[model samples]
Target: MTTIATPTTLYDPPPSFALVSPFLYRSSVPTSSHLPYLVPLHLKTLLSLGPELPSKALQQWCELQNVRLVHLGRKRDVVGEASTWKPVQEELVKEGLQVLLSRENAPCLVVDPSGVHEVGILIGCLRKLQRWTLSAIFAEYASLAGSQSRDIEEQFIELFDTDLVVIPPLENRIDGVRDVVNDPPLLAPPQ
Candidate 1:
């Protein structure tokens, strides 16, 4: 039996800034599946990120708070390479994007677990939309650990030539053991 976490609190829904949300769906399948529980996405906001990256904790947090989590990738490569992160195949990009376009009126949040390179790819996909707006972007900040973090944050800002906020790392307390996501976006409602 799959155990779904019960929601805890309420948060103001972010406006249709660009895309992202919460509601819940229960399934008989094991929770080990990477595919997140899909809520009705019609005109609903969504949050997406690079492949893998253990976003389940953040996803659950969003669900409990009524924020929708959109699963965009199914493979590790989709997250982009950590060393030379770049966009994947056109088909892969389109596959992930189909979810976003499915709800044209919806706003989305693109969280990059692999840092600037993945975010760059995400931005590239958004640009292809012809008529899409990026309300806000939150880059993952590994920590206050010397220059490495700064370099990654700077790269992320420079990639889009926009201001970027660094979100603290997220730990997967939901699953057994302490699995930590190096960089997970902070869940704050867009103004």
Candidate 2:
């Protein structure tokens, strides 16, 4: 009697990797211009903020830049209720983040143009992101003295190996610091 061998199909093989640009190894995305390179035109960006809406000027800028605005400010649609993002925060970490990692899919940028207390929690939720760094985190009113805000910055430094860049805002607000758009330096890992 002869025995025959059968092909095994218990487990699927991993997908074959494709060639990526050598320049991609660099810390930051290679661009023609030196100024902070915003997300590529190919990808649409979601600009999220607390319950309040962005200013008319800012909204116009985002529109011109082709960014989609999302309001993650309120826990629910009810009015006069305490504004909280607890409900959708988990979904953002699980579903929202994965989508951003996909180049074919557009990424997101959470900003608190009015800069309120909730901004700290937003930053904390953002810290959980693994695949991609936040495109930007603009806080129109930065309260660095607060432990929560400082913790957020510390987390960025530990994970990204670079300080959160504070980008100047278009218009000045109550305080001298117009905004706190923390753009990742996109720097190479230190040798």
Candidate 3:
């Protein structure tokens, strides 16, 4: 017989948690206290962005839950100069997009330390790929970002070349993007 795990307290999601799609979610770095709330999501993968290393506790939780954690950012040395830190690279974001588009990685959580800049930029680029208007994309970004939004991130999203994003083949594609891939916008475009 299988035993179901019951939560001892109310569900408390991580800071800035929100759904990106049916199978994709975005949020700030989750703490041990937030682990219980993640149970219902049945996450298959955790795509971590930014330069910081995940806590040992998070690693253990992922191991126990059978969730694959993929960290794309390079680690910053403790003694490294903060002024030398660079913005997230395009190559890494493209790789992350590929991970998100794969059906096998569905029910994935894309997280960063703050979930304001990195995650927001990624989601904005995704919206562009989905043919969403720039205004709409920026609106969504601003809604979550509040006062923390940056013009540089928005510029990156605007300049992002969706042509470079290689979508997975039909069989490997996620349900959310399947329709988008099949029925692309015509010359007239959506009003």
Residue 114 error, candidate 1, Å = 4.4
At residue 137, give the lDDT of candidate 1.
29
Cα-based lDDT for every prediction: 0.37, 0.35, 0.84
Residues 1-191 of candidate 3: C-alpha lDDT, one tens digit per residue? 99999967798899999999897999999999899889899999998886877899998999999999998766332244435433556776788888888899989999999988888988888888777899999999999999999888888888888778888777888764534556555466658
lDDT of 2 by residue, 87-169 (tens): 22333333333333334333444344323233333343333332223433323113332333444443432343212322233
List ranges where model 1 is wrong by over 4 Å.
1-44, 76-86, 131-191
State the local distance difference test value for candidate 2: 0.35
In model 3, where do residues sit more than 4 Å from their true spots? 1-8, 75-86, 178-191
Which sections of candidate 2 miss by over 4 Å? 1-43, 76-107, 114-119, 129-191
Clashing pairs for predicted structure model 2, backbone only: 27-186
lDDT of 1 by residue, 1-191 (tens): 99999867433332112222222111111122322322233324343445563356665655664655665545445345534532344434454444433434143444444333444444443442322333232232222122334444334333542112121222311111111234334465688
- The candidates, ranked best first by lDDT, are 3, 1, 2
Compute the lDDT of residue 170 as modeled in candidate 3: 73
Residue 115, candidate 2: Cα error in Å is 5.3
Backbone Cα, N, C clashes tallied per candidate = 15, 1, 0
